[model samples]
Target: MRFYGFFRSSSSYRCRIAFNLKGIRPEFVPINLRRNEHRDAAFLAKNPQGLLPALEVDGAVLTQSLAIIEWLDETQPGLRLLPEDATKRAQVRAFAQIIACEIHPLQNLRVLNFVKENYDQDRNGADDWARHWIAEGLTACEAIAARHVRNGTFTFGDQPGLADICLIPQMFSADRFGLDTALYPRLREIRAACEALPAFADAHPARQPDVQ
Candidate 1:
């Protein structure tokens, strides 16, 4: 398996966490988003969407971080990212979606670039846009996790799962934007617990090979 990703991409970070948890080490291929390598013809042939975190396994390429994660959960039987019980799985999925769907899309590189180009927003303006959406989404995420989190260590259960995989990267991004984590105690607590794990620590942006 070969993983194509950018070091600081939240979507790529999420997949890296899942890979560590599953104990699968794919060949790491850095796609330099800053240099527009993700848009190269070769990369577009693999995933026309031109997104980072595309995984090639057995001659098949998988795109979309969430889809790739769910594929991993299904194909790899050892560690389950999603719960077996239908209701619990739904709850976990919902928590993960709050970050993946509601928050991340607005703050991703393409969106930020779009705002900067069309609206004449500077770096500070782009960051403010990211923070606004992230804070709103995280507030709702905290509420949902508070209701459903079974253990203090993770978003869904005592062990890390899909929700934790999603939450930790979002927290990292939140910190990057100078968002005060104190605003969400439960989210911060869960993030702290995740940071203590080798899997999460190993997947951190600073630890990536592509970091300068």
Candidate 2:
């Protein structure tokens, strides 16, 4: 398997966490988003959206971080990334989507760059834009997590599952923007638990091979 990703991308970070949790180490292919490598013709052929964290496995190309992770869970069923129960799976999926769909797309690097280029927005303005969306999304997520927290450790249950994979990376991004995590105690506690695990720790952006 080959994984194309950028070190600092939260979407890529989620995939890294999933791979680590599944104990599957694939060949890492670094995509230089700063240099517009993802926009190159070759990469476009691989992923039409020109997004980071495209995965090539079994002669098939997979795009979208959530889709890729779910495929991994389906194909490699041993270390299940999601719980078996339907209700628990729904809760986990809801939590994951809060980050993947609601929060991340608005704050993605391309979106911020577009804002800077088209609207002549300064870096601070761009960061403020990102923070606004993240704060709103995280507030909703905190409520859901507080309601669904079963074991007091992870978002859904004790074991780190799909929700944890999504939450940890989003927290990393929030920290990057200096977002106040203190408001969300349950979310902070879950992130702390995740960081203590080897899978989440090893998948951190600073630990990625592409990090300089």
Candidate 3:
């Protein structure tokens, strides 16, 4: 398996965390998003969306971070990434979507670039825009997390399932924009639990091979 991705991409970062948790080591093919390599014709041939995190496994291409994660979870059933119970699975999916759909898309590189080029916004302005959306999304997440906290650790329970996986990366990105983490104590606590685990710490952006 060859994972083509950018080191700084949160979506790719999510997949990296999943891979680490599942103990699956795939070849990392770094695509330099800084140089617009994702937009190149060769990359487009692999993923028409011109996105990072297009995984090639056994001559098959996989796109979308959530979909790729689900695939990994299903194929490697030994250590599941999602809860087995239907209701719990739904809850975890809901939490993941809050970050993946509502928050992350709005603050991603393409959206920020669009705001800069079309709205005449500067770097600080774009960062502010990102923070505004992240804070709003985290507000909702905190409420959900408070209700689901068990043993003062994981989001759904003691295990780091899908919800925790999604939460940690989003929080990492949120901190990048200087968002006040103190606003969400439950989230902060959950993040701390994940950070204590070696898998989550190893998958951190700062520890990625291409981080520098």
Candidate 4:
């Protein structure tokens, strides 16, 4: 198996956590997004979308971080990222989408670059855009986890499953934009619990092989 991704990418960061949790280390192929390696012809051929965290396995390529992670959970052994219970699984998926779909895209590098280039926004302005969306989305997440989450150290339950996988990377991005964690105590606590685990800690952006 070969994993092509960039270190600072939240999507790639997610797969690293899943890989670590499953105790599987594929050949790590670093596609440095800062250098526009993801735009290169070779990488684009693998994923036409030109995104990070594309996985090559069993003579086929898989794109999208969430799909790849869920595929691994279904095919591989060791850890399960999604819960088995139907209702709980749906809740977890919803929570994951709140970050992956709603929050992440608004502040993605491509989006930020577009706004800055076409909308006359400066770097600081682009960052402000990111912060606004991240804060708005996380506030909703806080309501669910703080008011309704079950008795557990991590999100969804005691084990760090799909929600935590999604949350941790978004939390990292939140810190980048200077989003205060203190305001979301439940999220802050969950993040602390996740980082305490070797699986999550080892997958941190600062610890990645491609980190520059």
Window of ten residues with lowest summed lDDT in model 3: 148-157
Best by lDDT: 4
Question: What is the number of residue pairs that collide in model 4?
Answer: 0
RMSD of every candidate to native, in Å, equals 1.2, 1.4, 1.2, 1.0
lDDT of 4 at 124: 93
Task: Give candidate 4's error at residue 52 in angstroms.
Answer: 1.2
lDDT (tens digit, per residue) of candidate 2 on 36-115? 89999998988888988899988889998999999999988457898888987887898899899999999988799899
lDDT to native, each model: 0.92, 0.90, 0.90, 0.92
Give the residue spans of candidate 2 off by over 4 A. none
Q: How far is candidate 4 from the true structure (C-alpha RMSD, Å)?
A: 1.0
Q: Candidate 3 has what TM-score?
A: 0.96
Q: Candidate 1 lDDT, tens digit per residue, 26-110?
A: 9999999999998999999988988778999998999999999999999985689999999989988988999999999999888
Show where candidate 1 strays beyond 4 Å: 149-152
Off by over 4 Å in 3: none
| Worst 10-residue lDDT window, candidate 4 | 147-156
Indicate the residue-level lDDT of 144 in model 1.
Answer: 81
Name the top TM-score candidate: 4
- TM-score against truth, every candidate: 0.96, 0.95, 0.96, 0.97
